[model samples]
Target: MSTQVKVKNRLSSTVQSLKPSGIRRFFDLAASMEGVISLGVGEPDFVTPWRMREASISSLERGHTAYTSNAGMLPLRVEIQKYLEERFSVSYHPETEILVTVGASEAIDIALRAILDPGDEVLVVEPCYVSYEPVIRLAGGVPVFLKTTMENQFKLTPQELETHITERTKAIIFCYPNNPTGGTMTAEEWKTLLPIIEKHDLMVISDEIYAELTYGRMHDSIAALPGMKDRTILISGFSKAFAMTGWRLGYVCASPDLLAGMLKIHQYTMLCAPTMAQMAALEALRHGRSDMERMIESYRQRRNYVVDGFRHIGLTCHEPDGAFYAFPSVASTGLSSAEFAEKLLMEEKVAVVPGDVFGESGKGHIRCSYATSMEQLKKALERMERLMGRLS
Candidate 1:
């Protein structure tokens, strides 16, 4: 009888059932509070590399404001092809295999939507990027979470995946140099997964946005494995490495058949990624390697500092292999993940994401991004130490 009831009825059950992003909620709350030091949102604290920004500006000056082709500008796609092949040892034909999307986020949405039919099941690794399960549900697919343990360094095991697979299982979404937890797999680790994937004939949607941000060793893309090129749809973008988050540039590389289906969805829904963003991406590929190196060097330093800081404060932290987060257990404090995060925010004005917000396995931990400056990280850590001392 009420207008609110009518509006609620009109909303899709899928949307209604979906939980809001836990990361965003804390980040927003931190934003509203003065002097809150945030280690919550998984974003690079750096500005977009100047060359990429200048390239976009030059494109605007040249009046390149029109929408690009549905697949994106040829030059940008070519550069992306070259970059991926050279950097990751995975090759995709620029013309047919790549489609630039608004961001990797959009690429993820369309990839799932294009492949999934009603009731198909998708295996999602736990403590993943926040969007995976909700997007699967939105695509009319069932999301089956496979828990990854801290004891195993949060890397998804083929054995764990095998336990979760069933007749309805269609695909698996994997992220490495993962979010929430900065776990990564070596090429040898990927080799073990190859047979399981082939035996099950499962499609792979590999999200490698943080590939370039690894420490010590270069990122190893699973798509580089023999026989994987056709079955894997690789999603990545300039947002992480190039600090071009606001540019909304990303792309997906897949076999032509799969790409065509995703492009069909992309063309009708998004038309094309922004023309200017494509130009910037082109420039980033051409000239941004050094910029990425500098940022990575800074992150490596920060990572070491954050990890040591957590340990010195008497919390158990797994040293992240890549990405800019230190996921430390607050279990010694005798508090739940949410309780620890909330109390830290209230008592110390430091904001870190609650681990369980990522998945059930993340219950005793909190994700603290080291993306901020050394000074800020030091201050946040000091505040955390004070909180721990008082509690102790």
Candidate 2:
């Protein structure tokens, strides 16, 4: 007897207008299949290290379930401060400069929201991480993409960067040992970028989650450069290096004024990162260095194997100097990135992400995570080769 109300567009206009994550769409497709080999996910396949897990367990036993300060536990922030200084040569006052969050994802969100006002613009470097654009839009900032190409080794050039800046551009989201492409910039490269950033008076949201995973060269931070420290928001976590994705602990470091603004937003939205995760992250900074190194070595080996595998299979892959992904060109197969990926999944049962998911410049390629076991990597490569042979 009751009349039910039907709503066609109940979501916010922005939410409705925004596209669903291309990464998640492929993941959902892979999840529905019975025999798919997924290279679609960006997360590490490694488990949390035993000591960190044990630290969390012990904290739980010690009744650390109570909420930490909105800025997070001082002890954890202290350890984070130590780790950043020791690893990347950047120092911050733990008590005022660091705010722990649920994950690097949350760190990114709060940093954007704290800085952006309505109609402001942020320059997003791409082919890059997937989250930057959406987070900027959600923060009421316009995302002006600065696209990178394979010809440039997927590194943003000084010329390319300046072209994208506008008077309205308030910040730049910079990520490296980049996701999707696995590209990285050296200290010299950072030096060239510094003047442009300084000249424009841009605030940098530097996502260095993949910092510790770099190959050959030691990691460098933009925040470590002469006068860049105060203008940079440094975001990183234990998820990649310590194999603790599920632990979901991350931190953001910035000047006291910027940090205070971010913390206010974080307090209202996240309260604090999980207490157990904080305890585990404290353990990560204190004693998990060796474990982190071991995991990075493993990732390095996997990176070599997968990149070589792609090359052997006749796909042109840019050697990733950092991160656990290989961006291989599928253009020779005469299929669009989406077509190549979709067909590979249905026909060959190997699930890869289309490169364009990262940005328009990524269109002729595909992103394959090498974080999986060597056995799976081998099989996936063989299947891809077969698909290529058939297409040819």
Candidate 3:
């Protein structure tokens, strides 16, 4: 008899069927090449602010390494609560409404796990952050993709949202100041969608990870809306604004019952966020505002430059109101998004993520992140221009 382990069939059919990340595929490909200019990864090119690092180092120097409570350090939670109240006008009690997780990724997973029973439907607005559908499925929920268009500025209106709802719909995941598209929703738009959310009685997992990176306007948290607080699971983290991607810390704010349930999952899955990273994040909230603003300004400059560059290259590009990406249509080139990206990568040594991976609605577009330096942006623009010239 063959003694080989039958590991193939033992894998969860759901996980086994899941597709690999399209973004990471390009990132890995670029990493393998020499002198490839990457606008592929969503991570900030900046390092963590010096003061934040100093704070973490101080904690380590003072022998502060220890496991925090399963819910996370009370001090950090308090600061997060205060930060949210001041920044977004959302109030979450540190003791009862907050759960600090490994990162926004984990917060999302736990939020879905806490609420979703088998076959419950989650309304995921697309071209969103890529993780939403996979995470939903992992939690035994069905992901119902609702496509948003460039003509709509990628906003999910009450009308569009209502059309996608069904009796099985239990929650909606919103990621404004969105990834891939850099789209944002205005207060008036949220006001319009409020009734639909209230009508359906859906729980909301609001990923505001890129909240502070808005280009011209302040970010509004949906949790601040009247009667929306209790049903909203608000997730935000320091990775984007503070350039602390390596820290792996993020927090979720929800009502007591929801938070308590998530905490139970968090305690068993991840005991606490890294103690050192928590201390660093506390310092960031306390004193890193100026550094964050400086980074935002740099990103704003880059956004303008990249947008103009795409237009100059004869691509129709929408102005992203927030986040670091510029989503430009490659349809004019008469090539698929994957074709455009691969050809550009090979010809010009420039890397960008194909938009289709975000969702079907994202096809014929490419996401180019402006989180890199001006010099690199200029080089990438020149290379892209050359490629466009050849294609045209």
Candidate with top lDDT is 3
lDDT (tens digit, per residue) of candidate 2 on 305-387:
89888888889988998888889998888899999999999999999999999988789999999889989998998998898
Can you give the TM-score per candidate against the true fold? 0.97, 0.97, 0.98
* lDDT scores of the candidates, listed in order: 0.92, 0.90, 0.93
Q: Report RMSD (Å) for each prediction in the order shown.
A: 1.8, 1.3, 1.2
Residue pairs with backbone atoms closer than 3 Å in model 2 (clashes):
none
Model 1: per-residue Cα lDDT at residue 256: 96
Among these predictions, the greatest TM-score belongs to 3
Cα lDDT for residue 121, candidate 1:
98
- List runs of model 3 lying over 4 Å from the truth: 1-8
Relative to the true structure, candidate 2 reaches a TM of 0.97
**lDDT by residue (tens digit), candidate 1, 1-392:** 65644343778888889998888777887888999998886789999988988999999999999988999999989999999999999999999999999999999999999999999999988888889988999999998988887789999888998999999999999799888899999999989888989999999999999999999999999899999889999999989998988989899999999999999999899999999999989988998899999999999999999999999999999899998889999999999999999999988999999998887878899999999999999999999999999989
How many clashing pairs does model 2 include?
Answer: 0
lDDT of 3 at 324: 95
